[model samples]
Target: MGSSNTSFRQGFILVGFSDFPHWSSFFSVLISVFYSLTLFGNSAIIILSQLDARLQTPMYFFLCYLSFLDLCYTTNIVPQLLINLQGHDRTISYGGCVAQLFLFLALGSTESVLLVVMAFDRYVAVCRPLHYTTIMHPLLCLSLAIASWVGGFNNPLFQTSLMMVMPLCGYQLNHFFCEMPILLKFTCEDTGGTEAKMFVARVVILVFPVTLILGSYTNVAQAMLKTKSMAGCKKALGTCGSHFVVVSNFYGAAIYTYLQPQGSYSESKGKFVSLFYTIITPMLNPLIYTLRNKDVKRAVWKVLGRGTDSG
Candidate 1:
């Protein structure tokens, strides 16, 4: 929410707390534990990728970026939430609210863009194996990462700035953290244009990435069919399956949350989908990636052995 009224002393302040479920204690504990696990899991991914030279490859490079993004994205909301669940008011100052909105958008958008880049990396490695190294050269990878960050930075500027122009008065957000939709709902003004801009942002961040991932997998499938070898098919299928799983978990919940029509907003339903994307997906990424990937498994063992000997 934004304040257009220059004279208004204070902007939107959250007036009421959410009505927790009867089983809120159980759910709160679960949420707090999941939040801790997400931080630990993603932190390990970042650390392991950076520490182990053997894990330093184009794939794991992108993964480390993803893990870092997830960590930042999850941190934006979850820590505040734990504070709220402990019966604290969890009031964010106006400046702090804007910062939260920007960081959340930047990291979330970066992650979406990075996933597309990752798909292209996989496509090159599989479909055009001869050129994989040259195509995804270190410089190219660096440039792509920079572009993702730049795009992420710019995309949210429009949305957040627009909100800043509007005057936030008595409207309080319904959701735990500040999301674009929830913030817009609390603006207490007509959001006709804001809604459109947000929809466009969602398409830019999400739809294009999904298209790229799907296209990459389609090409991989075609290449595998041409190979006519069981081993070749298996390898191709394995790569595709891993990518699909990650993409589905990340994108599915995100699209459901963002792409809904403006007035059709269901607060409870929105909360559930937001939980899936914000909480569930980060927890799943490293577990799914490492458990299914042999190279990462070996690296994990190597690290464990070193730790054991050191201890």
Candidate 2:
């Protein structure tokens, strides 16, 4: 216990992208741009969803949650990452690393569950249009949103507790952030059982939600097939398609990172993959949703028009 506490106080060196010394500036610039865009894009979604009366449906309500999650998700890691990339000292305190791990896992897990909830919303709107309002009432929407948050935050507690107790052999973390697989590499004991347990948790968090989203979409596709109105079909496609695109981007990167065996993991590849889901995807989400969303565009124009008139 004394040794563990001492090690925790000593902190770990984040050996971020130090290998590619020449590319540090490039990565720094890239990460800064992406982080800025993530802040701007997600904030727009949240503000638009709240301010525009038309954007207050179950879908937009869920979207507002997603945007907020993305904002927090990126903010948690990106600043530390930029500092490491730009500065010579690349160390994170034990407490900071633990907090990062917990927040990252919680926010990420919340998104997986939230995506399923969003898919279900789409499914109900398309398959049971008449009952959509009653089914996805304000109370239900609020409950589902809260449930996503609760589930997301809970999974991380178990994972982070398990991680912090392990005896580490060294303090040099070979990635940009305090991720599970990378941290496991430093454990002094044989972690086969621990790895297995984490694998199960990952499946529960990542794979289970994916299965639900797919099932929801499958039902949505069947309902779309039966609909006769072209306009209705087009509208459904627009809304559902944007969501599916976001899902593909998010889940594809996440599954590739978490679902694989640790032995096969490459630090170089893992860092880039982390960048994808962490930085790039968050930056792209608002763009993905707003580009296809007519309502958001109208809201943007309405706000802009008001500003123009006032000016």
Identify the leading candidate in terms of TM-score: 2
CA lDDT of 196 in candidate 1? 82
List model 2 lDDT by residue over 1-311, tens digit each: 33544447688899899889999999999889899999999999999888888888999999999999999999999988998998667988899889999999999999999999999999999989899999999999999999999999888888898998888766789899999889887777787888888888889998998899999988988878888889988988987998999999999988898889888988899998998999999999999999867788888887877432222
Task: Give me the candidate number with maximum lDDT.
Answer: 2
The CA lDDT at 241 in model 1 is 74
The alpha-carbon deviation from the true structure for residue 262 of candidate 2, after best TM-score superposition, in angstroms, is 1.1
Q: List the residue pairs that clash in candidate 2.
A: none
lDDT minimum window of 10 residues, candidate 2:
302-311
Worst 10 contiguous positions by lDDT, candidate 1: 7-16
After superposition on all C-alphas, the RMSD of every candidate to the true structure, in Å, is 3.3, 2.6
| lDDT of prediction 1 | 0.77
- Per-residue lDDT tens digits for candidate 1, residues 236-277, read 777667767888998888888778886788776787788788
